[model samples]
Target: MIRPRHILRVFLLTTLLTTCLTGLSACGFVGFPGVYKIDIEQGNLVTQEMIEQLQPGMSRRQVRFIMGSPLVEDTFQPDRWDYPYVIRNGPDIIREAQVRIFFEGDSLVDVTGDYLPSWANPNAEPQGSTESEETEEAKES
Candidate 1:
């Protein structure tokens, strides 16, 4: 002999339990602990060593051989090629790099963006020469 009041109370408790469980399950979708995220890599991978191989007068074919195919080539600007790379962990970008190469006719003319040839990098230390040695040589000259 179940009373009407007892049935109503049981129904309310069940509804409340279900609601709480549903709410807790949604927390995982919002980046809760223990959630796994895979790193995503996109576009061409260009390295400083590859950039150093480039020379100002190299042909487009040589440039492509050293740097690989560019990620973007503008239709409106046929002489420009863009290489862009990115790594992401979920929605957060961990790393990004870009390089733009310009050609004049068949010859490579200019390069810009995240990397440059070692000869073109002003911040790069001169190979096999220390600053002190260079200063001493300058003083002698």
Candidate 2:
């Protein structure tokens, strides 16, 4: 048969466990809080409104008027303009893009890309215009 000392030991163990659980529950011991932000330094996300301002038939000069100078331009691929921006949520975490704009002659032709995630294809060729033309197409079709 169990002695009274055994009953006391069990009671002490249960009380210790309950006290520890209660203390942990009261403190910030679970589920870390998250922070949200906007207007990143490198990733100033150009809004859709800005893109909507651009039209299929807009000239390269017009696109410049809308989006400002690009962040990068290739020496060999002058038709390709890259707008790179980044947003840092915290250390080691970032959201960014180099929104590529491609031109054929002087007409703004296509969006090369905007890579936002780490897993996306960073080197996907700008979407349109395989050949850089000498003159802008007089009118878009």
What are the runs in model 1 whose C-alpha is more than 4 Å off? 1-29, 122-141
Q: How far is each candidate from the true structure, as Cα RMSD in Å? A: 5.8, 13.7
Worst 10 residues of 1 by lDDT: 27-36
Which pairs in model 2 have colliding backbones?
42-85, 42-86, 43-85, 43-86, 43-87, 112-126
- Per-residue C-alpha lDDT of model 1 across residues 105-140, encoded as one tens digit per residue: 999988889999876667878887797898999999
Clashes of each: 0, 6
**lDDT digits (tens) for residues 2-111 of candidate 2:** 99999999999999999998988875544346744444476335665676576565788898888887777799999888787776654444666667777888886677
lDDT per model, in order?
0.91, 0.67
